[model samples]
Target: MIEPSYYLSNIVQELKPSGIRKFFDLAAGMEGVISLGVGEPDFVTPWNVREACILSLEQGYTSYTANAGLIELRKEISHYLKNLTNIEYNPHNQVLVTVGGSQALDISLRAIVNPGDEVIVIEPSFVSYASLVTLAGGIPVPVQTTGDMEFKLQPEELEKAITEKTKAIILCSPNNPTGTCLNKKELEMIAEIIEKYDLLVISDEIYAELTYDEAYTSFVSIKGMEERTILVSGFSKGFAMTGWRLGYIAANPEFLNAMLKIHQYSMMCAPTMAQYAAIEAMKNGKEDVIHMKKSYRQRRNLFVGALNDIGLTCHVPGGAFYAFPSIQKTNLTSEEFAEQLLMEEKVAVVPGNVFGKSGEGFVRCSYASSLEQLQEAVRRMQRFVESRT
Candidate 1:
């Protein structure tokens, strides 16, 4: 028989699996674990949305959607964004429905990147940004943000990271791991740099609806940015539809067409049933979105407060449903803290370094869990912190 590794792709062989998986698996094995690890909303998909899916199936609507996704779904997305965030797209030409925000990220990277191109990624970012960039044969240049800055990316840093090899910058506002948001003023400055450097902006707004402090701003809403920004968003986070595997991208049709070519060959279309559900979500689910976010805001306050009270020195995240607390006071590496907390206290969270090395001294505690669970997680974590002391 051929050697097992003989036909494996070299890049795939060396790629490390997501850091969240190992800790999650460890948490799963323990009977009483309260896991704050996996980064997804804990809410159930609303009943109305499910009913829409069942209704569509009953009507015999199950079939392959157009390669770009159902036109109706795309139109809903376009309308949703325009009305809420002051951004507009021509649904027919400018939007492409994707398997998830993840596939949108992957295919967009693959479509834009040639071998050896560089993509500037803000560190303390979602873990997938770097790996996706690498898989697309682009270099991931991570620019670190710190607690002092509330985890916001600095315009100066973006300017410095850009070079001739730089093709794009992936910005995740309401950033994962950090849960920090970049406000309108900050984005305007960053937009200027993107213009000066003529760089593409891959803006991931998956957690847009969950922002707390500032009104969420789409990068494409910035002047002259519409032509240069690829906006990736989805129903999962906002609508508690993670299992549905639906996402969409709104971009200049030029980029949308290129991304579509990749989507067509790999994943032909997002789920037709999910798309039907998403149409209902986009149309009438605003109340549900508000209700969930209101609950998340309370969780955020409770968890962040408990973390700070227990001496973790967390920065208050402006948006998204996470509290990124510094574990430096205890002099523990993020992995050490997360793993030990799970072992000793059965409260699991993701280590900051899983996001990037800039995350070395912190831990990401998601508030997307129930309040009671979050309170228990906080209590367990407090005990762990004291034990270390």
Candidate 2:
């Protein structure tokens, strides 16, 4: 048996397996698991969006599109961003579609990061950031945020993490695991810091359409931040199109070109049918997004309040569908809390520590499930807490 190359890349060796996946794996094989662990929306893709994709299939649009994705889709994305976020970009050269926001980040990191370069990441962020940074041969500098601050990163934290080697800061607002959003003033402060230091920024606005209290702010909307920021977004969250595998990146031509080259080699193009569908999504998906956002907000309130009543001490997340609640009161580590809840109560929530060290003593509960599920989860959690008490 040819031992598969004894020397795997150090980048691969240094990475820790996903903390979320371990629980998911166990939950997957078990029966009667009610999971709030996954971050995906519970809704199906909008009917019209699905129809658009079917139309593309009927038209024989299965071949690979241009490396930068369909020109038509880029134009739609450009128009969509302009209408919603006031961010402008040329569809011709400023955008490159990818597998999802996840791959877009991977491509962007590969294009920009050199070996030993430092990439500042806020925690607890989505799981892919550090992995992508490692794959791109960059060092991931994790800056931990706290529940007290609603999990928002402070300007001072960013300042403390920066050094001569710093290449970029990854911003994920309406953040994963925590559901924290950075307000315009907060984002402006970060933009100021980045501009002052002349560092690049990768703004992952994948959950841009999911905000509750205020409108989503695009970094590109901030003056001078556009040139320095690479915006990453997709149809998954907004249009409930996760399985479509469609997302795009917008940046200046130089950065776009670099990502296009990597994308050309790695993915060749995003799914042609998905691109066609995305065009429809961009043009007509606003109503779909609004409907979903309204539902999410209702769920958010219900779940947050319910968790609080159950003695979880959850923050009222401003955006995204997750509720990050402390497990500390029960005197359980995040893993222990989540595991016992699953084993005894049949409730599957992700341990916050899976996202980062900062996520310790909390668990992330996604409220994208139905109201019935949310009600049941809260009842079970109440029982679990009472038992612990």
Instruction: List ranges where model 2 is wrong by over 4 Å.
Output: none
Tens digits of lDDT, candidate 2, 1-389: 76655667756877899888988997898887889998899999989989999999999989988888888889988888897678778999998899998899999999999999999999998988988998899999999999888899999998999999999999998899899988889989998999999999999999989999988788888878989999999988878999998999999999999998888888899889989999998888889888999999999998899888878898888888899999898888999999999999989999999888999999999999999999988998999999998
Candidate 1 local Cα displacement, residue 368, angstroms: 1.3
Quote the lDDT for 59 in model 2: 92
* Tens digits of lDDT, candidate 1, 52-144: 999999999989989999998889998898986687799999999999999999999998999999999999988889999999999999998
- Report, for every candidate in turn, its global Cα lDDT versus the true structure: 0.91, 0.90
Write down the lDDT that model 2 would get.
Answer: 0.90
Estimate the TM-score of every prediction.
0.98, 0.98
> Lowest-scoring 10 consecutive residues by lDDT in candidate 1?
79-88
What does candidate 1 score on TM?
A: 0.98
